[model samples]
Target: MEVKVPKEIRDYQESIFFGLSTRQFICSLLAVGVAVGLYFGLRPLIGSEEVGWMCILGAAPFAACGFFKYHGMTAEQAAWAWFKSEFLYPKKLVFKSDSLYFDAMKDAIAEGEKPPRKRKNHKPQPPTGKER
Candidate 1:
């Protein structure tokens, strides 16, 4: 069966996808630039030494972190994954995906809604559980 997204979901998905992709691209570029800078900056410190190994070792982690942080994962997914991987194993993937999907749904709904009233307790709470 074919799955179709509602207009609001489609809009929110498109917006979020574009926003996330842009941020990931920029962050990846910045990470690479920082790595390059480290290589060059270390040249003076290491006295033109073949510190290629140092650069690789040090920058690799940063690059990995940046990739995992911004590119390979979404903000919600990453946070959930981190929580699961760090504290809860075996059920990590299951929980994270469910939570992320729920969050995405809520974001789509919120994006489609009219502006909230300017009154106390009017602020929308972030999505929680599976309500989205």
Candidate 2:
């Protein structure tokens, strides 16, 4: 006779195997398959060393997706979001004018004068009754 006790529930999700969730497992498999396929397919045409590198390049993206996480999102999702934000709609398009301080510094340098240095804002306190 055998008895089984139910395990306690955790607040966070647990991995199905080796710290990899189902999606991660699938991603890892896909990455490995792609790498192996590429390596084998390219081996006859190119050197084995080159094929190995090609395998690495082909598998790196899915490996990243499988093995990495970002801000609670899967790596592939984060990567897509980043690609869209960076390439489709860049964040640097805002029309902000450059600061004239650097230009002034450059002009001063051209005129053979040293650039003005910024001073720290440390004001001396009036005589405190308590001594350090």
Candidate 3:
């Protein structure tokens, strides 16, 4: 008998039960538990139809968490990274460059070589009392 293996070793996941990885199995179990709990807990307060919807909604996140993987990161890791990038340590990068040569040569430029201009000084005139 030939054993099937993933083409990429990194993509391989050991199946714990029913062809599900340990993480998937755990998350699926949790999702089912949540759905059942929500259905029972909300059934008395809300109608069966609404309770069924609520159970699905409540269980979706748990199921998604187990299946989600990106760039080798799990759902929580991706979420944390997103949170950090969006809020915790967001960066607004401004590229500013200073030239040492330009600074050093500024005083030696043609404009800098010109002599400073003298300012005209005039005494202020007294205002006429009749002027409105």
Candidate 4:
């Protein structure tokens, strides 16, 4: 069955999906690059010693944290769950559109009330003592 979406809902969904997907893609790429760079940089220090295993183990958590933070998920799975429920759900479209419209209207009103631009202060300065 085909589903119908209101214009506002459709617009909001498009905007949010594009924004979040772009952000997630960029952040995931960055996290991967950082993790790779960190591994290469730390490898010299780690070497083939017994401490190398410890270093590798320590780096794993750091990489995981970086990945989570890049995705705006944080270290807390509960918080991420809450975020998906409260902010990212499809049903939140109504509230998002209302908020987006309210903000745009407020900005339009503010712009309308602004004063017109005035000319810059360009009056000539009086002659200095040195010139006199």
RMSD of each: 24.9, 10.1, 17.1, 23.5
Question: Which digits, one per residue and each the tens of the lDDT, describe model 4 over residues 15-79?
Answer: 33445544444555565565566566677776555345555565565455533653434556756
Cα deviation in Å at residue 8, candidate 3?
1.4
Worst 10 residues of 3 by lDDT: 108-117
Candidate 2 — which residues are off by over 4 angstroms? 1-11, 87-132
Best by lDDT: 3
Query: Global lDDT of each model?
Result: 0.63, 0.82, 0.91, 0.58
User: Backbone collision count in every prediction?
Assistant: 0, 0, 0, 0
TM-score of predicted structure 2: 0.52
Candidate 1 runs further than 4 Å off: 1-20, 47-50, 65-132
Error of 1 at 98 (Å): 27
lDDT of 1 by residue, 1-132 (tens): 998778765334332344555545555666677768878888878754466776666666545553464545656678888788788885434433557656757866677865345776678887888884
Candidate with best TM-score: 3
Model 4 poorest ten-residue lDDT run: 10-19
C-alpha RMSD (angstroms) for model 1: 24.9
**lDDT per residue (tens digit) for residues 1-132 in model 3:** 999888998899989999999999999999999999998899889899999999999999999999999999999999999999999999999987598866766776646675456989898989989898
Error of 4 at 104 (Å): 47
Q: Global lDDT for candidate 3?
A: 0.91
